[model samples]
Target: MVRRRFPVLLLHIFSMFAGTAGNTQEILYPFGPEHRDLETPKMDDGSSAEITLSISFVYFNIPYRTVYVNNNGVISFNVQVSQFTPEAFPLSDSRSFIAPLWADVHNGIRGDVYYRESTEPELLEKATQDVRKYFKNMPAFTATWVFITTWHQVTFYGGSQTTPVRFKCILLLNLA
Candidate 1:
């Protein structure tokens, strides 16, 4: 009985891999709020005053769609947040001091991320269809992984106009 159970367990684990681990690609979106300064009460004795600074921060994961084809192919799809308008999207609610200070894209693609504040819904639909078509033409994909990156500010003091924020994304591909 013990020997039989061992083989069953091994088969279960191996079967799980059948759907994951294949060609994968990642897209990233970068945005952030500004830095701000805070004031603190002075500790009596007429010496020096204290100050506390803070900023707002936000972070969330994007959803992805995984399609399993009849011929052992898999395709993953998701919106590219990197294309959102820097000014509109990931917008901050406050002004006195910005959160984030600065935002950037790391990993996946180098350089700066692009945004489309005025991008139309029709454009988005077209983009999605394009991606779907691209994958459909490919021979087959065993599995895929999709990832999204975001930045948020929490607290700040002032004089932080040029701080660098870091974001990252990576994709792994596997052959069956």
Candidate 2:
């Protein structure tokens, strides 16, 4: 039995090393037909705009929110000012309107905070246009906008009119 086991072990060892020499070259240079050389493509002279906008309203009090993403990769937001009122007291005259909302954009590297508030309709439109322009010129892949909404005056009923609410708008661009 011992002699037979010794011969089997030697045969297995010899067979293992017998194929090692032939497989060495295959392991070193693995250039098979399936492996093809790939090259990076050059950038195009004219580029088209392809942008996606994701807007999330953190507070539930906000009723109407609109987000627009144009072909130039610009993003604009239009939130109804009157929707900030509490649902319980919708017809309350004492409720104060939204004064103006401020926005700041950060693109990982740099950040810019716009001090102007969107008090009037025209000003709000202009602010949206300005935000769109800012995003259009941004060369980064990802950007975030922080919107701070404040009320002009506290409501007499004392419901949800004291503190400021924040909304976030994220822009993701697909360069492919």
Candidate 3:
């Protein structure tokens, strides 16, 4: 009886912990507007009318990994930023908004990157090479505004069998 109860207790605890994971949320920050035009115009009474026009642009980021499972059960790597939320971040400061930004990966404000590796000894080398090559020449990172943004839930897709995996969300700021 004692032995049987121990496994049941452990199972209950594991299930409870897993259930809490669904409570977390991921938020995406979209960019803001760009100041377009600002000029002083003549009023109907021949007085100077100040007309200040401001236009803003927002950019969003969507990153996803695509895996191609071959006949031998190898997962090919394809990591990329699916889309940029706001096309551009505009400001009147005469500075480039191309600077690096930060994001939360684990449902936090600071985003992180998701990385994983399998335990299969034969596949270990291939997985390492794939990840290294993927990171070697990644696309340019853009600033993602946290406010006035949208978010998409992260879900697992592809691969009928769920293998051991790890994930990370990285906050990338524009360096330039």
Candidate 4:
């Protein structure tokens, strides 16, 4: 298959390719006290202290047990990324990250970032249902690990007041 931008966002359960199945909107997962919150201003160009994953998450078939959740909507496996602007795909650099919506963002002035790793029964069930609904071939998939990073009500960095953005990346690792 062609190398495409990561597909299948859990938001409203839609693939990156819209119009293929009339997927136009993104419906994010509901956040509550369950997720760990990231501090602001401090997290403007910063990232969360490294988190040891409850279970290793394999990306590109490489197993990783640690990660840094950056304020700019990315879950990084290498060093935390503070670059506001996003590089094109097939990058020349070696930064490893899963960007749900990487951009010049700052939670310092306004907004919040939250993250968590869970295997909660309810969450797992929801994740499994979502994956099956979007990726039809994975009808029997059941998530054993779930990682979520959310940037909510965040403003732009080095700019005047801008529209607040709310987005999230939910990674479901089916270790079954």
Q: What are the lDDT scores of the predictions, listed in order?
A: 0.21, 0.24, 0.21, 0.69
TM-score of each: 0.17, 0.15, 0.15, 0.79
Candidate 1 — which residues are off by over 4 angstroms?
1-143, 152-159, 173-175
Better of 2 and 4 by lDDT: 4
TM-score (C-alpha) between model 2 and the true structure: 0.15
Per-residue lDDT over 34-138 for candidate 4, one digit per residue giving the tens place of the 0 to 100 score: 444444234567788888887767777677789898887677896888887888886688878788777787887777777777788987888888898889998
Best candidate, lDDT: 4
lDDT of 2 by residue, 83-117 (tens): 32234423354332222222221111221111111
Q: Give the higher-TM-score candidate: 3 or 4.
A: 4
10 residues in a row with least lDDT, candidate 3: 4-13
Residue range 130-158, candidate 1, lDDT tens digits:
34455575333322211211221111122
lDDT, model 3: 0.21
Q: What is the lDDT of candidate 4?
A: 0.69
In candidate 2 the C-alpha lDDT for residue 32 amounts to 19
lDDT of 3 by residue, 52-167 (tens): 11212122332212322111111122312222232354533332222122111111212112222123333333333433445565333222211111112211223122221222
> Which candidate gets the maximum TM-score versus the true structure?
4
Better model by lDDT: candidate 1 vs candidate 2: 2
Total colliding residue pairs, candidate 3? 39
